[model samples]
Target: MSITRRGFLGASLAAAMDGWQPAAAAGARVTLDQLQPGVYVARAHNAEVARANAGEVVPTLVHVTGAGVLVVDPGPQAAWGGALLGAIRALTPQPVRWVVNTHAHPENVLANAALARLRPRPVFLASAATAALMRQRCADCLARLQAQLGRAAMRGTTIVLPEPALQAGGWLHTGATAWQVQVHDNAHSASDTVLYAPQLRLLCAGGLAYQERVPEMQEASLQGWRQALRQLAALPADTVVATAPGTPAQTLVPTLAYLDALASGIGAALAAGCDASHAIDAVAAAPFRRWRHFHARHPLNVQRAWRQLEDLWMQGEPLA
Candidate 1:
């Protein structure tokens, strides 16, 4: 029998309340590489989410603090989150005190289910907009991930909404470490939260920066994203963590180039009287065709950019 979305979510929540366990049979493992003395990152495979990768296509950031550990973007599934928690325990005995979801993407936030099992549960945090988006979309996202990766891989996963929304320009303190939160709306997703650790000169840029990966633009605003990137580029960060792998300074380069090309190509297409249907072909893809997921995601990016630019044009607003 087909289960309704509400029914599926309700069942998942019931399972979670009954002390769900990670699906160890799925063979998910987490490995960490030190970015600094106390900063580390688990780099996800730079590819689309699949059963083979277990939907683990987004990087997870870990900050070891004197008080406890702070985890950013836990992961895509409960099993992966359990593995990540184990990896952290191996490195430090301090409990995870804070869990930060940089955005509302499934791959970035669903892991909170496993992490929620902590004895002294970590304070889950995200922007107000992100929390709202999660409330609206996470159930469907969870169901989709399960369908894509199989129930075994996503077993025990459930949606866990973040609490105490983080405000832009506010400071998040844990132990001696402080992260300046930067919030952007209508950019990467409906809301994007960036964290900068001044002491470590490290920046967790969420989906605002992609490393050699073609960004998904389904919920993006081309102009807003570019503006947010510009603001991020001005920060004094020595290391940047994002969705894919890249060096500090070069982390944002490919994303910027892709967005710039997308905007200009779409604008020109609009000026030439191309509608959404033809705009995809009109936008040049040669420069970014080699990027990961280019073929799968770039065409959609072109369509989204065309629509946004066309809307602006209709209102007599410059499509810059």
Candidate 2:
């Protein structure tokens, strides 16, 4: 058969699309930055989540000690979990003894099975509220994640429950390493928790801190979130781990400041009677030009924050 120039090019383009691959996400390469002697944080990408690799946008924290290793928020799939395990192996031969799921969001807690079924299963932990929330939502979450990231990207993934879910301030000891569990409500998520290593003065704020990008408030409470930020600031930990770029402390202030600004900005917009749908243009205006994902995330943040703030205003409750 004879083919025209356009036909040949179209055929080749179709084949390329059929066999498409994301070069940037070829493998899960989370950089391990050593915070102190034995503490490391595999920082995730601060930009938007993509079909390329959903888990690459989430960070994981690794703590090593004589007993074993402990990991925090191990990404969103079996693949990410395997990458985390390999990262752990490169650091130490010790098995992963514990995993702390800081929240129920898939970005933070979906890689349980990757390391749970090792020589000795790793004990996954979270706040009791989070465990209950995960048990209720994880099956749906897995299906949704598979749909969003594709079955191939989510292959071998399973929802592993965080066992022995402890209350707030519970002490979880893994060998010589001890993590003080600090859980807060309605902050970053319905159940938000931070792990504090008192000795190392390291705090893993999980979703509460966004060092680079504008904060996403889909499941957040502005008032409660601000209170939680204050609590996090008061903690003595010098080392902070957030999901975004920049150092922990540098990220900390801006994250809080952005949230405060977001709340007030939205509040003013609401008071001025801007429609919820159109408030994004007003609230997320020029001043936030410096933050990343302003256009991508600001509209959603404005919409969600407006509803909550409106509810509070109508009920005669202060927009805490």
Candidate 3:
């Protein structure tokens, strides 16, 4: 039986509400930096997720509009979300009218439960695929995070799936401010959502772009991600909100360079008949070792790229 969006969200919410408890007070602090008149970004650490960071290693974006507020990627857990809400309140008294989850990753969406506490709860949205993935995986993702960060750190964190899936080419408007939603599938994740505000010349490329940090490849498509980066580069955006610290113009550069080197190295290894076991070591990691979490994430990226390339080769697709 096919499940409709409303039915799916209703069922998910019903289940989530059964054991729902008020989230513990926010322990992590979120500070917003104005990117544009109505746009702001709270940058996260470029290191790996752990108990110290409280899994708060993803940026949170806030856009204040004449009608209300719109938040993107609330945060890692309920406390982080609560901290984010407090940060937003410091800027404006406007109610948060919309909450957009750019993807299904727990670091980005689990905070939805905390944000739901807002008066006249904000409408939560994500791409259809993202919502589906959240339903399928967020419970495990939440549990895993709790284990990694400890129960006290992840207190009150729960899976909160977005509803009324957003679509590409759709425009989200709040009075004078507007955002053009663009969805790229099989790139950074199963589905990635990017927001472009023409008036502000800003692009919020969620998980598609990272800066000063090795890109995570657990659920990424190297080829597809490269294509998405190309598309983003061609945009007229003056600022790109990425995972690490860097100028907006240079936001996609580091990630693009890393991806290119990874793909080329893997392709060369395949051409040399190197097995997957040796392929990880064969990739040139010297250049990226200086990047944050390089030791932890680069080898995994190489393995993932090698597997993907092997599958493509089996289908007779030429490596680019």
Candidate 4:
């Protein structure tokens, strides 16, 4: 069955009723007192860059283990990472045993160095493919950021590369809890990984799923992204925390709708002989605009969709 926007919203509402609030809402002002025992999200509150933006809010997670605490995707910048660690310390004195990077986005994985300052030197984990993608693509991404945001806004920007990369079916064990980290390469970005705790049926989906906004689809693999979400839907992840904070912890449908809309909208535009810019405008003016994050991400999503459609059509394949 096709997942629609309404269906996605309904899923989000259901998750809310199950005790998923904006974990990052508290991170807006100060480091939290303690991340509760259960799954809790950390939201980056950037007054200048992300205040007006609802989705740019980065998602980090804290999980308690009998051995020590595990931290996931420490915000983007050093300061944000420090604040996250501060928040974690407020929760437990147990050293951080692991620092997991969901992907290579500066706003997502650049805090490994700071996190390594811990007593145990947390093992920074990422997919081998993602680690390579960072080395090859990060310089270009940073250059683009410099061009777009200019030098002033690009201060303190560092590209982090992950070590001890995971292969397929990679597993990490901490205390009584175990995490299964898998690489769903060539999806949202060049490479992506999501953390799942099967025992709890909880998912830490980095960029694979976003909420409360449209996706920033630059460098996105539209078809691959769709396939990945399909695989995710097959999981029993009852609680989902996305890369964007305040996103309901278990809504799989919204991300599905956004991906499906982009694919279908691209197909419709192409069949109508619309140009890339025209397709972007048309999609944004119609179906895409209904999304809360549409204003910020529709243009990029359209660009990616058009490219993907163009490639597929040229190869004599129908858009899926």
Kindly report which residue stretches of model 4 are placed more than 4 angstroms away from their true locations once superposed. Answer: 1-36, 45-56, 137-160, 245-250, 269-278, 281-290
Ranking by lDDT: 1, 3, 2, 4
196-275: candidate 4 lDDT, tens digit per residue: 78897777788888665676677788888888888877887667777553323334677777788777877887888877
What are the TM-scores, per candidate, against the unseen true structure? 0.90, 0.85, 0.88, 0.77
Question: By TM-score, is 1 or 3 better?
Answer: 1
Residue lDDT tens for model 1, 143-163: 999899999888889889998
TM-score of model 3 (CA atoms)? 0.88
| Candidate whose lDDT is highest | 1
Tens digit per residue, CA lDDT, model 3, 54-104? 888887888889788899888888877766766666677677889998988
Q: Candidate 1's C-alpha lDDT? A: 0.82
**True lDDT of residue 191, candidate 3:** 93
Would you list the clashing residue pairs of candidate 2? 223-320
Candidate that beats the other on lDDT, 1 or 3, i.e. the better one? 1
For candidate 2, the lDDT comes to 0.73
| Rank by TM-score (best first) | 1, 3, 2, 4
Each prediction's whole-model lDDT (CA): 0.82, 0.73, 0.78, 0.64
The count of backbone overlaps in candidate 3 is: 0
Model 1 scores worst on lDDT over the 10 consecutive residues at 1-10
lDDT of 2 at 170: 83
